[model samples]
Target: MVPRRIICCTDFSYNSEPARELAVDYAKAFGARLTLVHVIDSSLFPTYVDWLGDEIDQILARTKEAAETKLQEIANKCGDLSDIKTCCEIGSPAEKIVGVANDEAADLIVVGTHGHTGVKHLVMGSIARSVLRTAHRPVLIVEASPLG
Candidate 1:
């Protein structure tokens, strides 16, 4: 089915650029509402340190702000596309991506893979793999470029 709403999730890594480009192409081609999502993995925060509530709040706020700025830049670059939106949240990347897809009722989800394999894949895990497994709708995975 041609998607009326598309969710494109990126980690702001070079690996995700291809996915973003493909999302733009699909969105433009289908005249879909494109929602760009970036989740700041809260798990990345240091667990060993005891952080004060205010400090944690400040850090999350700063991170969210930075992510919003980047998302806006990406949205601006794709200004020709229709009904573009940006979402920045703090949570597990895979779960948050899926949540956004459900919330947006996205017909399609586009994400980039790090192209990791074997031990590396096992060690680093794969957000794309997780999303592919859990998402109720169609998912398009763009492999990382070889130049990287």
Candidate 2:
């Protein structure tokens, strides 16, 4: 099916850069509006910091700002495409990515996979793997290229 909207998830990792490139290609080829997304995975933040006063909030704010800045940089690298959008969200990566896609009514979701195996894969729990299992729309997973 032809997709009119695409959401590409990026964590600014080396592996994810390839996905960004591929997503842009897909968006251009399909004539789709592309939305670049970066999930902060704020779940890593300590919620039970009872002793901290506003420090946690400050840290979270800074992290979110950094994420937005990085996302903007990536968007800029895509050139001046009027059809492009960027989002910075705080939550579990897979959940937030899928949620943004659903909220945007995206026809396709693009993500990068580390292609980890054995114990590493089990512990890290692939976001692309999770999105593949959960997303209702089509998902394009760009695995790390061997050449790179």
Candidate 3:
């Protein structure tokens, strides 16, 4: 089915670039509205530090701003799409992405994978894998091109 809305997730990493591009292509092909999303990993901060609340907030605010700016830059490069949206959220990347997809009633979820495996995969969980497993809607995963 032709999607009415598509959600593309990015960490602003090289691994996710292909997926972003593919998402833009799909959105244009289907005349769908594309929503580009970035999630600020809440795990990076210390939640138990009460004294750091203000500091954390300041950091998070800056991070969110930067993420939004980057998303806008990417959206600007998506050619002539009429309906492109940018979302910056704070939480687990995979969870937030799935939540956004559900909340937006997105017809499709597009995400990129770092193709991590072995110990690295064990240590740093795969967001794309989690989204694929948990998302209620259809998901399209783009694997990063292998490094030379």
Candidate 4:
């Protein structure tokens, strides 16, 4: 089946760079429309009520701006594909990514995994794994680091 649409979720981490590249290549190969998505995990931030008196708004604004810039850079590096789109969302990363994929009717979802094990894995659950488990569409999980 032809993948007419693809959703790529990125955290802009060094580990995720390869997944971004892979998504671009896949999009090119399949002649698919690509949507580059970045989700801001708001849970990491203090509650809105708690931050009302602080610089939280400013921080959020700055972070969004930076994410947009980085998303543009990623799109540019992916190639001159007119069909490419960029989106910045706020919520749980994995949930937002899946939500976008569903909302956009993506045929495939691409994500990067650090492949952490042991205590590390327990602490930081695998977003890629969660997506793979819950996504209705096909999911591609790229290991952040290369394997020997």
- Consecutive 10-residue window with the lowest summed lDDT within model 3: 120-129
Return whichever of 2 and 4 wins on lDDT: 2
The residue-by-residue lDDT of candidate 3 on 49-133, one tens digit each, is 9987699899889989988999999989989999999999999999999999999999999998877789876654477778989
CA lDDT of every candidate: 0.90, 0.86, 0.90, 0.85
How do all the candidates rank in terms of lDDT, highest first? 3, 1, 2, 4
Estimate, for each residue in 90-125, the C-alpha lDDT of model 4 and write its tens digit: 878888899999999999998987767888765544
- Model 2 clashing residue pairs (backbone): none
Q: What TM-score would every model get versus the actual structure?
A: 0.94, 0.93, 0.94, 0.89
Q: Looking at candidate 3, what is the lDDT of residue 102?
A: 90
lDDT of 4 at 109: 94
How far in Å is the alpha carbon of 63 misplaced in model 2? 0.8
Q: In candidate 4, which residue pairs get closer than 3 Å at backbone N, Cα or C atoms, i.e. clash?
A: none
State the lDDT of candidate 1 residue by residue for 1-148, as single tens digits.
Answer: 9999999998898888999999999999999999999999998886556757578878889989999999999999995886899999898999999999999999999998877889877644478889999999999988886674
List, in order, the clash count of every candidate structure.
0, 0, 0, 0
Question: What's the CA error at residue 128 for candidate 1, in Å?
Answer: 0.4
What's the CA RMSD for each of the models?
A: 1.4, 1.5, 1.4, 2.2
Per-residue lDDT of 129 in model 2: 85
